[model samples]
Target: MTQGLDIEQMLAQHIARLKASLQQASGEGSGPEEGSDAWLLLNAFVENDPQNWHTLLANFEQSGHWLAEQGGKLDVRIVALQRYIDALVAELKQILSEQPLLLVETVERLHLLQSESIQALTRGYQSVTDQCLRDKDMFSQQLEHRLLALQRINGVSNSAMDLDQTLEITAQAIAEELQVDLCSIFFYDDMQRVLTLRATNGPRPLGGMHFTQRIGEGYSGWVAEKGQSLLVHDVMASPNFASEVQAYSSDYHGLMSLPIIFFGDAERLIGVISVLSQEPRDFTREEISFVEIVAGIIAINVENGRLYEQTDEQLRRKVHELATIHRVSSVIASTLNLDEVLQMITTQAVHLSGAERSCIFELDPDRRRLHVLAHYGLNANLVGQLYINVGQCCAGRTVQTGRPSMAVDCFHTDEHCFIRSDPFISSEIHSVLCVPLKVKDKILGCLCVYSSHRHLLSAEQMQLVNLFANESAIAIENARLYEETRRGLELKSVLLRELHHRVKNNLANVAGILSLQRRRSKSSDVRHILAESVNRVQGLAATHDLLAHEDVSEARVDEVARKIVGVASTNLVPPEKHITFKVEPCGIVIPSRAVTILALIINEMVSNAIKHGLAGQSVGRVIVRGREEDGWVYVQVSDNGTGPAFNLQFGENSESSSEGLGLSLIKNLAGDLEGQFSLRREHDLTSQNGTNTTGDGPAEYTVAEVRFPLVRRSRTRE
Candidate 1:
């Protein structure tokens, strides 16, 4: 109560101060008012208290209740309470008026407190909003970076050329960019229902792509089968992701698989892109969308590469076909010898048709056996030994029936010929095709091709084989005709040689009769011409003897020269002091006409050397040397004895001995040989004394030399 009295005293002092001030200013007694702006402001402050606000608002709602409650307060007891309250109000106004700056300061302080709280709340909200914006910007930047990497990959146009390399590149890029522990691409083979690891990056296993995940069984495979993206936040926890060997030690987690689908053809899922991480990372909607775009690009490129390869293979096959046709045509156009042509055809057939071996078997006239007329792949022993009876091997059957025969697999067929039995049949021959080699209506032979595998040749290849065989049959027929023509020519030549022999013998008989007549009636001129004619006939006979004795279809130049020299030497030189003969070692061969002509030329030269050069001398030496040089044959006949003047003209008009006839014969023979003829003085011309002496003045010993070109003959006639 005494404390209450101190409150009363304080209020009285405030009221007294205000009353004294107001009386000095306006001199009016204005008490505590029923209505005032200060009172309303004070009431508003009291109403703002959350705990008492409702009760104060209720109190303010009823003015009559407040007045009735204060009506009994006019009593001294109530007057004192009211006076205390009035004094409290007057003191509150006095305090407010006396310290006007204090009132303003209190209002400003309260406003400052409210403003500080609002400012603190705003700062906190701004901080939270800023953090959210930064997170959004970071996400946007990460998306942009991912798109840039995808763009970089798309810029590589050459990747389309090779799919394996492209997949590998994409896998590696994603692994590096995403900081993934594992990245791989699996290509789905629809036919096999298996996913093959096409490309991989980061920590490749021992054998790359060794493990295969079945479609609808594992995470990647199921995603590919369903043609959708898949996210395995924890691989260990995923039901689809089973591990044979646990790669994680309970800490490793998370995996992502994206299906690579062809855009236009959505049902055809090409493959899947898989990414693995050690830590769990939530893949947002945007990230999955980006991966899908990458998958579409990959799928389209793989499809494109496959199409190109298929087209390329088809083109290659067509090129091979054209080459085979051209090769077969060339073989048909070239040769006329049947065996030679058939061998050529077999070789070309094997080469062009890509067969390992081939053969041409002809039907022997007996028709009992198929003869291997020509074989390209046969060894030396097998060439003639390889034969089969009619209705035996493929070739034999083709010949017997006059129809084509083919054994797509020789190994599968037990019907093999006895004659055709060989180690090669088991080791090398596994397939065979044979066609009849016929001329008009006759089956001449069978053309056969062999390989080391069953059905290795295709339908197109078989057609080509048939075409080539048909063309080759015509060539074979032409070769047979050529052979017949050659045999006829050879027979005619033999008959002509026999005729020559008989004619020479008849001429010899006539010469013998003429010699008897020369011994009986004897006009010297007649005898001389007759003897000369006999000598010419004898020369012809000697040529015929040589041609027959050599037993060759060709002429021998050496033999002709030696025989003519022997004949001429006997007649020209006496037995007591015969001219020493020096003949060069010879083995020169020439044509029949050239041989006869060369023999005559040698006869004349040797006769001249013995008769004139060795005359009036005993033990005289004559040398006959023949040599070939620079495509020509040179014959030199020389002697140490005296001879007729070489410089003198040697025709019927000249004063030469019977030697003129020999010289004339030599000139004619030389002309026949297509040779150059010349007569010159022998070098080192002397008597047996070895002194430099010209026994016959300017023309000591006559020497004849002839030069003729060597004509090369075809050794074997076609």
Candidate 2:
């Protein structure tokens, strides 16, 4: 009886120790302090009964729950653990009070057993407490790791990386913390049956074991099939576990598997994570829960990785589209060859869309058939050989509908069905998108893209294709416009050349007729008249020479003055006569009408200067000066020899003075230039001088200054 009492005392003390440990582990200090006498007495009671620990833990959990209840929602699991410890304390106290007393010798033995039991209980409690804290620490670290993995998988800091490098990092993290021989991830193919190895960490080359296994065939496959986590205490005990393939080695023992489910609009089963260990180890709830969270994060990361890759691919394709558009525009601008332009469009379409095949189909003028103007990925012999009826293939429908058309499954479409004559059926075109190349109502051609997978075209992709096709059509039209302009310029050049030739010949003929009249004339006056006529014709011929050589349709006023003065002086008058002919340096271009009028003005003025102004003198000076002021041409011809003097009355009528024919002609030509004319004598002309010089000379010197204005013509024929 004394032994029982001693055992009860020891058990009570042990129970107190266990309760104290639980309080410390649970971070509680309200009920009992860890090193107090009550704690020691509780430990003594627990030492007599191993069941005391369970009761203690239950009581601790209940007290914790009551304490947590005031704080609203709280950790129920923690409270349960704390309550179990509190019950343990109560049970030990009850056992201590009811037990009988023991003998002194028996008491000693009981004390020894009580001490052993207390030590064992203390170790067990401490182990569980430490494990709980460790699990929490591990979960925190795992969450941080998942965040970092997601960041890496997003390619936040890098442009791209190898899949193996990404997989290795993920697998190694799971293996190292779990103390597992191997950790691997397997993904189901589109069929959802075959599993492909994605990530693994363990022995060498184990990651390389990528055998296709069915979803329900092995441990990892079973987890995926169930869409839940599984634990195998021993791989040999599992019914569905395939040791031959999944076993990292013959010594492999324990295994755990979790299915990776991605959370999104489409909650897909991405893959399965498997952990294998060399020793059979019972997995705790924390371990199982940790793996499940890790798998979920991994699923999200993988989906993010795939989306990132797709975004990068789309960016590259957009850049290529811009580059291709610029290239085609440049090609069109540089050349007028229709075939070359078509070929460029086809080749760039293939490269930009990453299509296996590409072709440009131009609509026949009558819209009856589509002609294969250019093609890439087709044999040379079949390039132009392929044509379809207007309402036949995808290209034809695009033209007929005047809208973009896309066939997700070209081989299966009811309308715009596939043509059997398509060469190179090596890769069946699962998708076909086409855009009509139309300008206003004219359908020039259709630009098409082909892909190997069905439903591959997105709205944005269709828009890009349509934009490219529009660019192609614009390029073709630009080429046509360029060709037309070039041909027009060539024709204009030919016409101008012929016009210059005919003008020169006609002037020469007039000069020849004048020469014939000059030779056949009898009287001196007749001879002079014919000679002047011949000289005028020759002046026109020289004007034509300058016009043809200088490559201009109009005559230069300054150059015409020089040529006419030069030709008239040599032919119209005697060579022995000395004359100074001078003209201003400023140039003015005159059209055909002004050319003739200005020539006549210069001709009459210069001729008058030579004939009448230098009448009785061998040496004479003639100056021709012209300037434009207020749109009027002021022309002057002066001489220093004898002719009209200051006393001479100027008459405007041609019939009044036969000597006024030259003056009359000058006045008429000036009127033709839309100008007012006035003839004036030079300053040195005979004014009221001191004395009259010699015998009545023909007259003093003469000077003719004429003003002519440029007038613009209106469309109204007046």
Candidate 3:
């Protein structure tokens, strides 16, 4: 068996040398004509293996089984070798059929050669199997190392480290795993179509490295553009590689650039991961595939980190917005002062929005112009001087459109017409955001913020400013309403005081005229009637005086009653008659219009008590009381005198009644007050014992009481 294996090895070597010599001669164009001498040589070798071809095929199948047992990488190589052996056996059978019959001695040598060829094939299979096992072991170690690196990368990614630190960690892990001189991550900016070198791990320090390349420009950019991986063994020979992009003072011999494609869609390229070697070395297929998987993991980590940053930034912005709104709302709710509210709005807007200046312009009533109402971070001279006409500038355009207006890079454009003017021209404003102060379809004005840098306000930032503007608009409207209400109240108060003064003076003049007429009257009855009329007018005039002094829309019923009783008792009761007046403390307030009628009712009742009840008597006592209960007011006037002989019913127009016209007038006044009026006689035992009495019984008293629904004015006191 050993000798046969040696012979098979020697025959395999001879065949290989013959094939090489034929191929070399063919290349030099000095070989035999096509399919002539080369065909004969190959046919002779196959004739030596004619009889044992079936045995060789069986042995090849057994070897295939053994190769299949090795599994994994050896399976494909085993199948390909078996196909080649089967094809060679068919060709030998065809060649031997053309040779017809050979000698029996030649047939014996053919069988021996066939056995040696099968042994040689078996030896070759064993050699390939041994190499596969060694490769498999090496692959296992490489896979284990890659897994450890990936685990470390995952650990860094899962940690709370920020995006930059995580990227640095990923770069270091890739460099260590691949054993490369330099590993760099280039982040692609889709908007700019440029790849910026973000993180690097190499011999050279990573400071002052600002390498960038446009898409399809350099090795990394080309990989990104093609959305594929590239392995260049020699950087100098590669057309896409640029030496300037390499790390400083480090020799770069080879480059491997892999696209950081999003996992689900391989076409969406986000960036590139590049590994460089100091020596010219060809990358193995396994190494290339390993780097591709690492690139995918890195891509996932990068995407996760980007999303985390965006979410975290959004959360921070939302928190800041809520805090700003709370602060501004607190300031707005604290006061109704318009100027103070406007000032707080502008100051807080500028501070929160990171603006160099902010101003609020109020639209005039005509809506044709904007006037600067409040401002912060602007020169005092520029505030009032900066005005915008409607449909002319940023502030005006915002009002015209009833939407927010923005002008980024304002200095280079004519978009902001307002800033083109004198005061704003010197302000050096580059960006401006103007939001209309709108409330329920009413555009009150515009709120504007100016920045010195272009594109300073993002869309989210603009939305935040708009929210603030909405709150400011509400605060401004509230302040204006408050101011208008205050002014209206002041005007009403002044008008009310003037009206009361005029009415009091007019009533007094009428009472004075009546008094003069009473003095000039010839008949005694005429003088007496005029005097009574003058006293009634004077009572009403006294009520107006009380109202004028109080400076209110309603007068205290008790105060007005006391004043009326004093004037009536002093004027009607003669000096010869001893009449004492008693008024109870009353705490009820009634409308000013009702005061005149109330005074008249008190005057008639008191005068009637003094004139008729105490006509013949020299002494009398009158009592006046007023109070409120259950939404109703009661005023009672009573006198202890020679009581009337008849009962007085309210609403009775009887002229012959002992109370006469006073009772009729009292009944009419009660009807005007929407009240119930009654006059009755009562017996007072205490009065009878203390003073004058009628006959041997207690003195009779006349009491007049009126009960009315209390119509309270807005301004009232208990």
lDDT of 3 by residue, 1-718 (tens): 5544443454464554444455454444544333332333343444445444545555454554465455535445444434433434443344345443332323444455445544544565666777779999998998898888878888887788876788788888888887888888888898899988878886543344577878988787788888888878888666557553454577787788889888664455678988888888788887788778777777777776666566556444543543345345434433456787788778878877888888888899988989898988876775667667898777888899999988776545555565555545545788889999976689999899998877759765676577667766767776665666577876555544443454455456556655765676554665676677778777876876787677546777778878888888778888898888877667688876577778888888888888877789898778787767798898878888767676655643434344465776678677768877777787763321255333346666787788788996665676
On the 0 to 100 scale, the lDDT of residue 708 in model 3 is 83
Stronger candidate by TM-score (1 vs 2): 2
Q: Model 3: runs farther than 4 Å from truth?
A: 1-145, 161-280, 299-307, 351-357, 363-370, 377-379, 382-444, 448-462, 481-718
lDDT of 1 by residue, 429-508 (tens): 77778888765568878878888776657765675566557656666655554566577975544443543354345435
lDDT of 2 by residue, 1-718 (tens): 6655665566544644556555655456654555332343254344545575455444444443444434433345334433544555444445445543333333454345334434443444455556668988988897687556545544522335565666667677667666678888888786757788876776533445665558777776677778887777888766568553344554667878888888899879888888878789887776676677667667766776777566556434543453355345434433457788777777777666657677778877777888777777766665556667776777888888888887765554444444434535524777788889876668898988877766767765665566567656766665565556577975543444333344445446545645664576444555675666566656655665665565344555677788789888888667778776666564555554566557667877788778877887777777676665777666667677655544332334333345455666566556656665555554443312323222245344456766665544322111
Better structure of 1 and 2 per lDDT: 2
Ranking by lDDT: 3, 2, 1
Clashes of each: 2, 49, 0
Please list the Cα RMSD from the true structure of every candidate, rounded to 1 decimal place.
34.8, 31.6, 31.9
Backbone clashes in model 1, listed as residue pairs: 612-642, 613-641
lDDT of each: 0.60, 0.62, 0.69
| Clash pairs, model 3 backbone | none
For candidate 2, give the lDDT of residue 505. 53
